[model samples]
Target chain A: MKRIKKLDTPPRFISWCAVGGYEEKNGPLGEAFDLCDESDTFGQKTWEMSEGEMGRCALNLALSKCSLSHETLELLVAGDLQNQCVASSVGLDSFGAPFLGIYGACSTCTEALLILSSMIESGAVTTGACVTTSHNSAAERQFRTPLEYGGQRSPSAQWTSTAAGSFVLTSDEELIKNAKLSNVAISDFMIGRIVDGATADGSNMGAAMSFAAAESIIEYFKESELKPRDFDYIVTGDLGKVGTSILRAILEERLPSAAGKHLDCGNLLYDAKRQDVHAGASGCGTSASVLASYFLPRLEEGEIRDILFLSTGALMSPSSVLQGNTIKGIAPVIHIHSSAD
Target chain B: MDIYTNEGKKEIIKKFTPKTKVLKNTLLAFIFGGLISLGAELLREAYIYFGMSEKDALTLVGVTLILLASLLTALGLFDRIARYAGAGTLVPITGFSNSVTSQALDAKSEGLILGVGAKIFTVAGPVILYGIASGVLYGIIYFIYLYIIR
Candidate 1:
């Protein structure tokens, strides 16, 4: 069966919002974020609770941006880096909508959107929401170490983003008119297969996840019969500096022309040298927040026409990493275009 | 597709991954670690000057170092120094204190019993287990040497 699916009458992303923490608020595209908490706490006593609050706030902002209520939300697809996806489930539980919790790790944003768009296209859901979040402290405690742990981070290690992103997608043109900004639509998507590059290092996640990104891009190019120049940019989720170069090299071998059009969410989120983020940023929020705040707005304003947004994720747990198992990478691409198309 | 294989990807990643500054890190670690040792020695000397025995002074110095490390970890300053210090902070007793204190602080949210009490030793557990185990093993070997070989 084909992994690429073209949505019939693409569902328009009517509203979206991005919420960020201290580091993210001071990032390069800091001002682009809709909401930010300087303390990174969001008034929550615990980091885990803070992460969940971010998801809740993001979804609320998204709904409010479109002037839509939770009742209108026919379906919700959400996930986060938390174990069993607790952040999204507990955070968004108050919405009381038909909810589906997914686990795509960092690829959650695109995966949620991909699933939501398919539901809308099938007329199974008229309105849906896609939300994902990640907090640096929470993720570090779960994946690597405690916040106060004094450990040297490798040069290839990436800082997890403490941010959240939410999007409201709808098939009804009437509701689309009520959206704060409505133009971009989900046109097509390709679900990536699990790929292991045999990288066992947890600190250097970009290396482990780059192969899956290459697979998605190469496969998309082959199936779509499109060149790099056809789209404004090809965005990858949290590949960082290391993974970006690796991806470019892999693309150069087969599709040399496609190498230069790449932009990694990890690279875009932080000023690596200035921020002292050795490699770059990674997490569900890294790509989700960037896309919600930066790319989608650009698409909506007609600044860019067509772009392929690829959300890449490394599918590995702490247990798996500790067991000397190789990290498995998965990336799913979403074809989002300006309504001008 | 063949080009995207694990072996091919590894070759590509090796070319792109940036090199770590081992020499620079080592130099920093050396300076920092040496400075920490010097401070401890001075503290031990100061304690001895106060009419304390050498053994008592040494014990007091150990307690002082542990208190300083724990305080820094609690104040959230140890990790910052440790970042650039590399193994400098880790090789010393300060590292062990920081590990235990940090773990305790992290799990403090889950409550004192199951949280801090249980998880306080998670990071330092291996070091402790192996340290004692190896010491016991060495003792057994020494006993055999004393009774038989000697």
Candidate 2:
């Protein structure tokens, strides 16, 4: 593979939006979301269909915010926690853009963004959208047991956030100027390697993904010759409270000064005490929705200048777990900087 | 960070892992299970009032509850109820029925014989097999006792 380096001309996020189910909307960051459907089903027959509807809803919101139509979108890169990324495919089918369906498990948000930004930087597409979604019931049925099973959740297990988040990005300066939107550029990114923590227990996903998050951060710092303190904030995707602590200890050993700035999207997405979320929020939407609802706006308002957004994913299928294979994890990092910086 | 070493990684993972809430979960299960049993008793009493014998009422109530659970599972409502009710739903016969029906429904797409037919018993098959085995064992023991007494 070619050496990973910072982009020569970073692609800017022109607009973004997050839509979530009732539970997430009532959570701590609830008010920060762009839209919240009162019904988890989104008026769909099945939970999977509802998840698809969420993706469509988020994409529509982002497009509307930018005053752009589906026709104006050059490409659509999206994924969900479902097999074959069916949610994204079915959800965004109406949009008349070339679709690139990618999957990185729950880390799909940052992974999709990485791909979208790279395409724009390569001059392949001037405008594209990165979308990802996850539904609690749908994911539970697919990854673990059906909801009716009433299986006890391990304390280490995270509650999947029922949400979808989309970002409209562009290399065109005119799009931003016309829309009168502040630019949030994708400054740099590091694609993580699949790191196995040798964990066989799927319930302890936080432990499984923590090593991947730490490795990605270390690799990014080494390649860029930057310290953790260099970024205004270093946020990880879906590594809940426990995973965050593990990540912190790992980072502190190598980059002690920067470890303190670390925050986890999963931990920040909900209030653990008030909410029944044992290990806090997770899924692709955990990071995607949080970034769209909270951090992206903060970046746009210049409240934060630079961010190292690392979305970690535990890549395991039900069959893999059944076969006694250990869970392997990957975390893709995206460096987003405000134009004001 | 040479922490990628096996021992170092294990230590980091262990340090951050949270303890399971055994007390809370057990309490939830106990409460829910009690509620389900209470509901069953109420149903049985209502059946008795309608002139059915006590034994018949009890048998009818169990069948009625199982049927109701399966219907709810089909409508995609039982799972939602189960989420909140937790162990309350799982400890009852209704929970067992829901598990069977839901798995069958999930496998419907794979076709009747190979999919739903095969997978319908995936969760409940062991319980059913053991239930029959124990019932036959009790019958044999009772017969032997009667023969010895005679």
Candidate 3:
């Protein structure tokens, strides 16, 4: 099966927005986020409910950014790092659109983008949005331990970000002909193959997911004949410090140019040392919030030309990790570029 | 070099993966765990100084440690200290108390019976099982020695 596909009719990014909790609001790109709740609760009683609210707020803000109403959206592709994707389903249920729920663990954001872009390019769904979110407290309870549990984290363990991101895309003929575009679009994308790096330690997810990121980048490079220097940056989802180092070493001999252009959302989302995030940040929100607030804006404003955004995910449940199964990883790459020309 | 195979990628990951500071973690764990033990000893001595019997004092000290650990866990302070303390809080009665309390706190959102009751032992269940199993095995050996050999 072909892993890479170049969109003949790329979908235009109309509007985007990001919502984050207190920790994320205090991060480097804090000011860039569209909305933030200092309480991290979003006025909800439960962490799960708070995570759901983030998705709701992200989608609402994305639509309102361009003064678009709810009726303007025909489809909504959304996901979250919750069991059965409850965060997306329950959170986005109020939108009352034709919704398609997806799960790619932390890579849900890019996966949703890839799917939404494909639907638009197919001309089946001309106007749609993709939303994804993750909460640290919720993820900790489900995937690792209780939020209040006293346990020492490994140096490689990444702190989960409490955040959400949403993007609105369209391939409507009338909108395109009228020059109503956000100046950023999905040009091409490559769906990643699941790869296991043989690291069973759950705390060190970067090791578990690094192989998938390397493979996705390598295959995309081979298929498109595009070197790493072709893009301004090769942004990875949340491989954090450990995954980034391993990815660099792997790409050093193969895709040599990639090492210099590589950037991980995990490292970029937070001040690791100041925040006491051992390795860096993880979760679907880590990449989604970064892409929505940082990359998409820069692309829209034409500050950067293009980026190969790879949202990587470690597909491991608490049961799988406990059963001694190796964590599988996947990263779907989307070639997002400025369409200013 | 071979990114596809597990063994090939493992070698690459090992090269780039940062090594955990074993010496530092060990020292910290040792010092912290010792501190907890010392605190327990001091509590027991204080109880005895107040005219409590030695046995009663020891039991009271154990209860105090569990209570303090539970309160700290609820106040969300134990985990912060445990982050730096490593196994310091984990190897003592406090760690056991924390395991149970943390699970209970997490499950409380689900409900009373199914959430807190059933899931409370999620983390500490194994310890309880193995601890009792070893005790039973030792009791059997002691019984055999006392009746047959002695």
Which one wins by TM-score: 2 or 3?
A: 3
Query: What is the lDDT, from 0 to 100, of the residue B71 in candidate 3?
Result: 99
True-structure RMSD, every candidate: 1.3, 3.7, 1.6
Runs in model 2 deviating more than 4 A are A1-3, B6-8, B27-58, B64-89, B101-122, B129-150
Model 2 residue A282 CA deviation (Å) reads 1.1
* Residue-level lDDT for A174 in candidate 3: 70
Please provide, for model 2 over A56-82, each residue's C-alpha lDDT reduced to its tens digit, 9 standing for 90 to 100: 999999999999989989999999999
Ranking by DockQ: 3, 1, 2
What CAPRI-style quality would you assign to candidate 3? medium
- Give the TM-scores of the predictions, in the order they appear: 0.98, 0.87, 0.97
Residue A309, candidate 1: how far off, in angstroms?
0.7
Interface RMSD per candidate: 1.8, 3.0, 1.2
lDDT of 1 at B92: 90
For candidate 2, the docking band is: acceptable
lDDT (10s digit) by residue, model 1, range B1-150:
345566866776777788889999999999999999999999989988988999999988889988999999999999999999978988899999999999999999999999999899999999999999999999999999999999
CA shift of A65, model 1, Å: 1.3
